[model samples]
Target chain A: MSILKVNNLSVSFKQYTSGLRQTTHQVISNLNIELVSGEILAVVGASGSGKSLLAHAILGILPLNAETSGQITYDGEVLTSKRQEQLRGKEIALVPQSVSYLNPLMRVGSQVRSSVRKRNAKQAQEEVFQRYHLKKEVGNMYPFQLSGGMARRVLVSTAMVSGASVIIADEPTPGLDKVVIEEALNNFREFADQGCAVMLISHDIESALKIADKVAVFYEGTVLEVAPVEDFEGKGDRLRHPYTQALWRALPQNDFTWIEGSI
Target chain B: MRWQLTWNIVTFLFWKAIKMASLLVAISFISFLLVKNSPIDPIQAYVGADMLNVSQEQREKIEEYWGLNQPVMEQFMSWSSAVLSGDLGTSMIFRLPVSEVIGERFLNSIALMSVAWVLSGVIGFSIGILAAMNTGTWIDRMIKWYCYTLASTPTFWMGLLLLIVFAVWLNWFPVGMGVPAGVLAEDVTIMDRIKHLILPALTLSIIGVANVALHTRQKLIEVLSSDYVVFARARGEKGFTLFWRHGLRNIALPAITLQFAAFSELFGGAVLAEQVFSYPGLGQATVEAGLRGDIPLLLGLVLFSAIFVFVGNVIADLIYRVVDPRTREGKSYAVKQ
Candidate 1:
């Protein structure tokens, strides 16, 4: 079933001018996408490519100056600006970059427990806690006590605790070492295996192609192209669009670039 | 576990404060010596013009009576020794013990100041939090305007304005004085004294409330922008829980620090407010003693104000340690933890 779908999503921020003038900067323009249950859709783009902005718009956590106009249907219910946050914890969960969500003052275990209570479920709370290998007393340890890798694990664990059908993670592992990235990618795979719709937003094409069932490329505030992971198999030159071809050639395995001028 | 941590923090803070107090003592000694080295002589003010024309024998007798015949170093030592021994010396003008004079007025000021602080801290912080939560809205704009206006005006001027509006224009409260003369009479009721305290307390509190709100609003803005607040919202915290429980707790450290500074300044500001309202508080006592050049009283008031500031900072530091465990753990607390 289609758990989440975005149709014609566009977001703009109001720009103020001195001397009674004003304008609007359209940050995300005409973004359309869909996610089915138990599928991983990867959003690939470079920095400033509006990937995070799109995720924020979908999460309904955009700034006050941001104006969003689009139709989003999650589980057949229309998504509106007013109800975006309502969908966030229950219908959708967002794992922001950096384990910043884990408040430094609060313990990792308590943070996860809070997420569980917010979901109003007590059954799987312990199960989830144990599955993450979090010490039973870990709730007593504050976020500052956790290592960077441990903090990220706790964040992912908390996001899944609420049983939100869809998870949108932005730049899950941007600058981590290879081992940490592998761990992060494995975490996303586990979430997807739970029959949850997962959207992995990243700039690394190679990382996205690793686990994504469907891959979408974002550029200049729009989804440029999307295809199955199968399409990336030894078909770099056969890609239809110039941007997609550039992206394929830029992958680590395809360092042999026939086209210059940078993807 | 949190209790144990807090207990450790409190003990550690107590030792830190003791160390800080020792430093304050050194600072006080140096300042006393520096002041003594200056041109002003308390003796010159005490000796009458007739004494200069009198015999040196009689002058010497007078000097001995006042303990002025001793060396300057001995005099300062005597003063510090007296202070440490719980004797602030006699008031040169009042012909009364300095401690007695201060004790007479200290309770009144403490009472009035406490009332003013509570009013300001609660009301101001609430307004600030609400305004910040609704920033860009009309309520936020209104609070901004009010806070700016109140914070910019001096407390004395604000007190005067209140006196005019409530006493002269509306005739709702008494003018210039704290309690009525009858209230000081032995037979007067306690309720009457409270009634008289209202105007002075409000006068002192108006500016305090404004300042608190301004500080709280600024700090709340900083806190709300932090990532933790976003995380809380994503955790489905909406409405009152979001603003009060989540947002307020995170922003509390800065707001509390602001409140402590505000509390420290309350004594100094209350002097003017108390004087304007003719309230029999420390400021009024200090002013009366100052006009008469009562050295003991002046020094006592200065010391009291300094002590209040010192205590305020100590409380702020203790609270900071409680609010931020990382602060207790030091600069590398995050890494260490």
Candidate 2:
């Protein structure tokens, strides 16, 4: 059963194109995806392909310029903006893309502790930190004090301590080393194993494939195919959509080139 | 770790003190040069129309008394030595010790400036927050227009306008002077002083409000749109809770820096406003000393103002570190039990 479902969502806005002239810039259109219980759905797309917009849209944190139309049902009910606010950081949590998402002025411990909605916040944060191999003293440090890898772990810990039913990790592995990347991927897998729905948005399809149960190939602001992870192996011929097949063939370990095919 | 944080603050303060002391020495020397080079004759200005009647013998005696007969360097040395020895010399115009005059007038200036300073910072900060939170709205535009217009207006002109309207036309407050006429210092009540101070202080604060409000609005807009703030909002924080938790401290650091940097502007405005309203503060004394060639009084005022502005900035920097945990380089603001 789907714990979170986004059906036919479209996001567009009007902006001034020239002197007193306006144009509608549709960044995402007719997008649909779902997060089911105890599974990792990796949504892969190129940069500027509305990957992050989908995440923002579902969280109801889109910019004011954006106008979104769609039905987003969470936990068997339509998720309104008001309901999103109540569930945010409690029933549903987001692991943002950049370390900049951490408040520079706040302590790492306090930041994660604030996310713990139901439990002794300090103990929950400490347990998560220990699981990630972060030092006890790291809790007192600011975001800037942490290395690239520690910062990412701290971000994940913030979500883990929340114990949310659905966790959305957005572009979490960019600029990270292989070791740290594997650790972060493993952390997301653990979250899904604990019965939470996890949506991992990333442009690095290769990394996403390592832990993802289902791979959703997004192109032209819409999902071209949602196939099981095994379908991506052995030349990608079993993939239903031509774009997904091309994307798989174009991977560095594969063809490294995207061939034009039937739409 | 606690010990280290405390030690760091002490070291910071010590260095600031050393810097301020050296700056004071430089300021005093330069102001001395500027004062000595002035073409105005101290004796002539001091005697007024009686200069022609005074014989050469009387003139020599007067010059000798004030050490004007000595060489420039020698005069400076005498003044500097006296200052180093805790004496600010005597005011030639007022016939009292310079320190005594400064102390009495500084009390009055402090009252006016403190009222103006607090008023401007609190009111301007509130207005700035309102404007930033309501960006692209009429309230934002109105605040921007008001700040821009007031920033370009002269302090004295604003003083005069308020004088004409509130004090003259509306008869809301006293038109001028620091107190009621013929009232002894002992007889003047706090209410009387407040009534007289209202107009001049308002003039100074109104001018100050423009710079602070505009700066705060710009800074807060950037802060509100920052990534962390967006993330915090996505974390179910909004309205005053979001602003209080995330926005306040970030803008406050910059606001404080701007507020302290405005001390010189505040003092400068007070000088002009004092002349307009006949307020018997240090600002009024400043102009009189400069125009009358009172070296003791003029140098004294310059030194006092330099220290005043410097101390304000030092306090501002200290407060910034206290308010902003990032400045301490990962030293946690709170200790876990």
Candidate 3:
């Protein structure tokens, strides 16, 4: 069953050019996507393709200047702003893109513990940290004291300990080593296997495809294709959109050829 | 390593002390030179025309006694040595020890200014947070307009305007003065003193409140848009929790520094306010000493003000260390590394 659905979503920002003169620029237009129970759906796109905007919109965290039009349904009910606030951090958690998302003044353990909805929040946070191979002492450290990999793990643990049914991991694996990235992906897979859903947004398609059940190719603020993972194999012939095929063929393992146009 | 850290802190404090002492010396010398160069002679003002026709021998004795006959450098050396030895010299106008006069007035100024500072800080911070939370709304625009208007108005002008509206026209508060005349310090109740204090304190606080509010609003807007705040918002934090837990904490250090900067202005405002209101504060003493060409009293006031500013800065630094763990740890550990 689809746990989340977004239909005909469009986002535009109003900017003032001069005194009392304004213009609206549309960034995302008529986008449609869905997340099902026990699935990892990765949305892959280049910079400026509005992949992050989709996650923010779903979380109801779009900037005030942005105007969005869409029908978003969660759990078979309309996901109103009130409902988004209600579900956020309790039922739907996000692993934000920037490590700076960790509060500089707060300790890592408390930050993770703050997101836990379970009774034994401390135990859950420690367990998450142990799973991520973080030292016990690391819990007392601030964000600045942690290395990049450790900070990323802390962010992931914050979401993990929330016990949310749906997790949105936005570019969570950058600056991480190969082993850690694989471990994180496996954790997501294990998480989804327990009947929760995951939306993993990233530009690194190769790593995303490693665990993604479905891949949605985003280009120019709209989804070009949402295809099964198997379709991404073998010279990109099965991929429906030319942009998706070009994206696949341009991979270093495939043709190593550059796509002609800039995003 | 622990010993080394302690030693570094000790050395840092020692250097600061030495720097303050040198700055005080420079301030004293400059003020003395300015007073000496002025057309008003302390002896002429002190003796008055009644004593002007006294014997030349007696005049020489007075000049010699006051060390007015000495060269400028020698005069400074004598005065500085006297200051170092705990003698602030006698006020030529009041004929009292400069320390005695300053000590009495300093307490009064401290009472007035501290109350104003606390009042302004609380009101300004509350308004700033409210304004930031409602950015682009009419409330925010109105606060911005009020702050800009208050900031552009001169301190003395604002004081007089408040005096007119609240004290003279409405008859709500005392027009001026720290306390009622002939009222014994022990006889006056806190409420009576507050009644007298309301107008001057309010006058002194308006500029500070406006300044703090504007700065806090600007800083909070930036901090609210920061990545950490957005992340916290995504964690289901809203309203007061978001502001108190995240917004205020981030804005605190900068706001405190700005508060300390505002304190330097308080002394300047206090002088005008005290004169306007006939308040017996350090500012009034300063002005009287300057007018009377009382070099010793003027020098003492200048040095006191300089030290006050320096101590305020030091306090700000210490508070920063307490509130910000990053700064505390970085200074200690990074130095060792």
DockQ, all models: 0.49, 0.50, 0.49
What's each prediction's TM-score? 0.90, 0.93, 0.93
Whose lDDT is higher: candidate 1's or candidate 2's? 2
Model 1, residue pairs in steric clash: none
lDDT by residue (tens digit), candidate 2, B1-337 = 6677688899999999999999989999999988788897888977888888999999999999988989998988988999999899788899999999999999998999999999999989989989999998999999999999999999999999999999989999998999999989899999999999999999999999988898889988988888888788767778897888778867887888889878898899999998899999999999989888887898999999999999888888887766666776552422321
Q: After superposition, how far is residue B253 of candidate 1 from its true place, in Å?
A: 3.4
Per residue, candidate 2 scores C-alpha lDDT tens digits across A1-263 of 78999999999987887897988899889988899999999999888888988988888988787899989999989999999989888888899987799887778888888888899999999899899888898898888777888889999988888879899999999999999999999999999999999999999999999999999988988888899999998888899987888888887888787675532
Regions of model 3 farther than 4 Å from truth: A259-263, B1-12, B54-58, B182-191, B331-337
Estimate, for each residue in B1-337, the C-alpha lDDT of model 3 and write its tens digit: 3565467567767888999989887888788887778897777778766675878898889899988898989988988899999999888878899999999899989988998888888788888988999999999999999999988888778888888898889999877777777888899888887887777778888877898899899999999999888888788888888877788888878788777766678888888888877788999999898786777788889989998888877777656755676754543322221
Instruction: Point out the worst 10-residue segment of candidate 2 chain A by lDDT.
Output: A254-263
lDDT for each residue of candidate 1 in B76-141, tens digit (9 for 90 to 100): 788888888888888876778888878878888888888888888888988988898888899999
- Chain B: TM-scores of all predictions: 0.85, 0.94, 0.92
How does model 2 score by TM-score? 0.93
Model 1 docking tier (incorrect/acceptable/medium/high): acceptable
Instruction: Give each candidate's interface RMSD in Å.
Output: 3.3, 3.9, 2.9
Give the distance in Å from residue A171's predicted Cα in candidate 2 to where it truly belongs.
0.9
Q: Roughly what TM-score does model 3 have, to 2 decimal places?
A: 0.93
